[model samples]
Target: MTDWNGAALEKIAAAEELDLAPERPNGTLRDPVTMWMVRAGHRPYVRSVKGSDGPWYRGTQSR
Candidate 1:
């Protein structure tokens, strides 16, 4: 398993606000889309607003 740095981990844990998005192959970010964030243990996750059918979501899968 991979280990995360304490300070970086804390930053994510302490975040009350987040602007998360998946990167495109061309190195640009997808259109600004809002999604909920959830944490389990020390890991954070974001879900697709358009679910699997979302363009941004699909873009991530292709990479």
Candidate 2:
């Protein structure tokens, strides 16, 4: 596995403090709507706000 630098880790930690969620790099804002994000230790995780049946969720399953 790859390791995270202190700055990257801190940035992620700070992002977790906000209610805003970042958009997918390749996705348009209106396409998937809101995303829910969280940090566990040094790792980040994201989930579709629309749940497992959401378009974003379905897209991930196919890949």
Candidate 3:
């Protein structure tokens, strides 16, 4: 697995939003979903404001 460097983490944290395109079971990418992200210490995290019922969140579970 790839690890995040300090610079990359800073860049992502600086952004107000990010786009996530989750892969489907068939290996095709779903539509990009705009999401809010945060840098927690050395790790990055994201969540669906719409909660678990959000379409984007559900799509991620498929992968």
What tens digits encode model 2's per-residue C-alpha lDDT throughout 1-63?
A: 566777877776665333433356576344435666676777766667778987767867777
- The best-first sequence of candidates by lDDT reads 3, 1, 2
TM-score of model 3 (CA atoms): 0.74
Which lDDT tens digits does candidate 3 get at residues 1-63?
Answer: 356899999989998788888777789988887788987788888887666899987766775
TM-scores of all predicted structures: 0.60, 0.57, 0.74
Clashes of each: 0, 0, 0
Which runs in model 3 stand beyond 4 Å of their true positions?
1-3, 60-63
What are the runs in model 2 whose C-alpha is more than 4 Å off?
1-3, 16-32
**In order, what lDDT does every prediction score?**
0.69, 0.63, 0.81
Ranking of candidates on TM-score, top first: 3, 1, 2
Model 1 per-residue lDDT tens digits across residues 1-63: 565577776777675545666666689976676655666776767677678997767777887
Is 1 or 2 the stronger prediction by lDDT?
1
TM-score of 2: 0.57
Q: lDDT value for candidate 1? A: 0.69
In candidate 1, which residue ranges exceed 4 Å CA deviation? 1-18
Per-residue error (Å), model 1, residue 51 = 0.7
Candidate 1 vs candidate 3, TM-score winner = 3
Q: Residue 9 of candidate 3: its Cα lDDT?
A: 92
